[model samples]
Target: MNVSLQIRDVPGEVRDAIAALAAANGQSMQGYLLELVRREARVARNRTLFDRLAGKRVRGLVVDDIVTTIRRGRDDPDRADPDVA
Candidate 1:
């Protein structure tokens, strides 16, 4: 379902700026605003999903310590290959 949206009390300069930006991007003002609205909705949906999963943990999965992982990578003994040089 599609419904018309009306925005009131927008300053002239702000409206003109949006129009100019839409023209620069080769889109009508309505299309540009619709795209912006859709992007914002997607961000809100992702935030909701993360909030729902805030403290729940899956079983049987061990998460490694970050510092230890980095140190192990840095201290690798077989880093250099003799064939490369």
Candidate 2:
């Protein structure tokens, strides 16, 4: 499948640089952009790195939670085990 995009107001110098970089990477400008899109899509689907943060609330953390988790990890050796209760 092929998609067409229209990019406007691109400075000539920047466009030349992008074209040179893409050529160095063995891709046309369009191919480079498409590859970048595909990579980002795959990474998003993997949901391992930064994708786990989607639609989550994290503004309510206090100092107690931090200290508690640290203490628990240090105090309990078996807490991280899944097969043992």
Give per-model CA RMSD.
7.0, 6.2
In model 2, the runs with Cα more than 4 Å from the true position are 47-85
Local error of candidate 2 at 29, Å? 1.2
Alpha-carbon error at 35 in model 2, in Å? 0.5
Residue-level lDDT of model 2, residues 38-67, one tens digit each, is 999898778765556655758878999999
- lDDT winner among the candidates? 1
lDDT of 2 at 32: 92
Q: How many backbone clashes does candidate 1 have?
A: 0
TM-score of 2: 0.45
